[model samples]
Target: MLAPSPLGRVLLHLSNLLVIAFLLLPIAAVTLGALQAEKTLQADTRALLPPEWTLDNFRVILSGGEQRGAIFEQVTYLPDNVKKIRFAFTNSTVIALSVTVLTLAMGALSAWTIARLRYRWTRWLVNASLLARFVPVITLMIPLYVAFRQLGLLNSVVGVIVALTGFLLPYAILILAPYFDQIPKELEDSARIDGCSRFGAFWRVSLPLAAPGLASCGALVFIISWNELLIPLILVNKAEFMTVPVVINSLVGDVHVFFNLMMAICLLALLPSVILVLLLQKFVVAGLQVGGLKG
Candidate 1:
């Protein structure tokens, strides 16, 4: 195909810039908001820049509300959840990591089976997994809530991890199966001929070859689990067990909303996922490209 004309190239560049700006707008708002006091934020509703900036919001959050800086000197109260920010962070980290590990382990096995076995039932299973994605998660919340309550799993990190793992498993399978399918069967056969068992062939040869796909899926799973609100919100009500998203949600009170503090928390919550994606950028891109193509 002929290269685009100069004008067409310019238009494409402009379009790309617009889309990037659209995506970055929220981050900009959050960063700006996080750097200022609530008063400054409210003082100039129309102003793009805050008249003054402060790190007190982060200080208070990081200190677990023990140190009230100049901005919060006169404030009589802070949200309980804001004070427990560390717990939220800990819970979120634990849940996300656990879910990623579990999803990768189980998803790798299932996807490899589905890809290599090519049985009629495996095709049906793939269709079922796809169908699971179509069902709104909200619809399943009630039943899940009831079931977890019966099992005494409510108000626990394990419950949230379980729920998120099941919810995200289908995505892992779908993303990973293509990678496994594209792997040459000869490699596994060679491993088996070298005295490796069927499972040993997978463990030693196929799984290592699917590293890029695993990285991509793990990053996606971690981000999803880290940002998940509904599962934790529905399953866990205790403050100590709450994740970052749940704590962030708690910032909005019935009487007053802590917009500045909330923005600071949002920035903090976004850091892990952003860092993970950046670190795995190459693997993720390569994995996505390979997974999208048919062998």
Candidate 2:
């Protein structure tokens, strides 16, 4: 392997620094906003450093019930529900994990068949999934709303989960199919030669080696489902079913919009996705590299 010249190395380091700064800059701003005194934020040109540190904003929002002031209130107009961040957090976790697991199970099986089975329809199915993934969720919002309303799925956690799964499944199938295709065919063929059944070969051999792809698909689903706002906003009207994004969005309408508290909730809403990426990042990188290189 040939090493890059000195100038190439400098350029590579510069490119990495630029990407890192781009990612961290917004997070740093949000953190500083969360910590600043409410008074300082209200002033013109918000400063990076807080004039005073106070937990009062977080305190007020957490404890104020329907009485708290924040920007999210404009969307939902519920002051009492903000007090139950614990419940919102729980609901978000349940929905996200459930969607991730369901998507992976269905997507993996389908992708495996599409990759290994020699059928003309398999190519069409893969193309169909690609098309579905590109369709904007916003375009389906009104129709989905009416359908869910008729089915009594509106204003329910189950409704949100179903809707999100529908939106995420296509992307999962698209990503995983290519990864499955990249796996060495000889491995499965050898297992079959030993008298193993097709399903047995898949379960015992191929599935284990597809972990990186599975992890990547699962992580993407979790992040998107956790951060989704529009589906939850339309499907669930009750405060009790509200997810974190919906809850955080409901903070806008109070007499005073508590910037500090809003920023704090925003930060909290980001934690699960952050931890997920950190833990599964290796798999994600490997999967992307393999899929990209092959496809």
Task: Please tell me which predicted candidate would have the highest lDDT against the true structure.
Answer: 1
lDDT of 2 by residue, 107-160 (tens): 888899999995889888888887886677788889999998899888788888
Clash totals in order: 0, 17
Quote model 1's TM-score: 0.92
The residue-by-residue lDDT of candidate 1 on 14-51, one tens digit each, is 99999999999999999998999989877778999988
Q: What is the lDDT, from 0 to 100, of the residue 221 in candidate 1?
A: 81
